[model samples]
Target: MSVMVAVPDSAEGALALTSAIAEARLLGTDVLAVNLGLRPISPEHLMSGETRITILERTHHESHAEVVLHALAEHPETERLVIGVKRRSKVGKALIGSVSQTLLLEADVPILAVKLPH
Candidate 1:
């Protein structure tokens, strides 16, 4: 089955993404990384398993939650969605709303929110 994951443009995001994809691979699932702007320049490592990373160059500025949800809507291959949620204080969450919040509240498909330790 296909699994969609939104990977943000950050090292922490990338690491969390790789971990999620790798785990999904082990579970015998197809992993697709919704990379908005920050596409993987190098081809995905084979040892890491097969993953299709789709980069949206036009969506870097817009809300990534919106971008990935729209992408999932467009792609028939998307079966489920996963995304990382770095721990946030109330003030932080207020200052910059979390994508996890948006996806949890708005996405039509099942979303697996990976909560990162603070």
Candidate 2:
């Protein structure tokens, strides 16, 4: 089993990545990181001797939520999905759908939602 995380180019994403790595270490499993950012994640910065991390690139055609869900479906060994979330107004969420919300509702696997410290 492995831990999966959706990593975007934001502070929340960074926290989620760090949290996923820590959780994987505890679970004694590897990490499957789905990169949702426009730019690729730096493997050298994320890699550690204790845990193995594999970064999956996002296709141009796929939505952020789709990419994450697809990765989970592809990797049946994924024990958990880690995602970073921030507060959003109801109006904002209504106007712009939330990826985290979609994952929370649709993902078949367990989800670990992390947030930045105020």
Candidate 3:
């Protein structure tokens, strides 16, 4: 089995993703950490090899979900997906939208979400 993790350009998101990757390893699932940074292929900040990391450029300003879906469309070989979501209180949740929420709702494969520690 395999999993895709959406990693944004933030340290907290990265840490959460690393935790999710560790969990995937324990679960025997291959990890694919997708870094949709400001530009494509900016794999410089992250370590190499321990996890399968792929950095992609944003295809559209409003089409991030579609970009992710298209990227993983060929993952018939994978089993699941993972993403990181920053924890938020009721008021916070009311303000900021969540990518993890959208992915969980739309992805054809099962989605797993890791949140920033409270």
Best by TM-score: 2
Off by over 4 Å in 2: none
Residue pairs in collision within model 3: none
Tens digit per residue, CA lDDT, model 2, 7-70 = 9999899889999999999999999989999888866549667899998888757888999999
- Residue lDDT tens for model 1, 53-116: 4443435366787888788777766667778778777899889877788888988877777655
Worst 10 residues of 1 by lDDT: 40-49
Sort all candidates by TM-score, best to worst: 2, 1, 3
Count of backbone clashes, every candidate in sequence: 0, 0, 0
What lDDT does candidate 1 reach at residue 41? 26
Global lDDT of each model?
0.67, 0.91, 0.65
**Which has the higher lDDT value, candidate number 1 or candidate number 2?**
2
In what order do the candidates fall by lDDT, top score first?
Answer: 2, 1, 3
TM-scores of the candidates are 0.72, 0.91, 0.69
Q: For model 1, what is the error of residue 86's alpha carbon versus the real structure, in angstroms, after optimal superposition?
A: 1.8
State the lDDT of candidate 3 residue by residue for 15-113, as single tens digits: 656765676667766566666667443345455346555444456665556667766785665567767667679997888776667777878987767
Q: After superposition, how far is residue 64 of candidate 2 from its true place, in Å?
A: 0.5
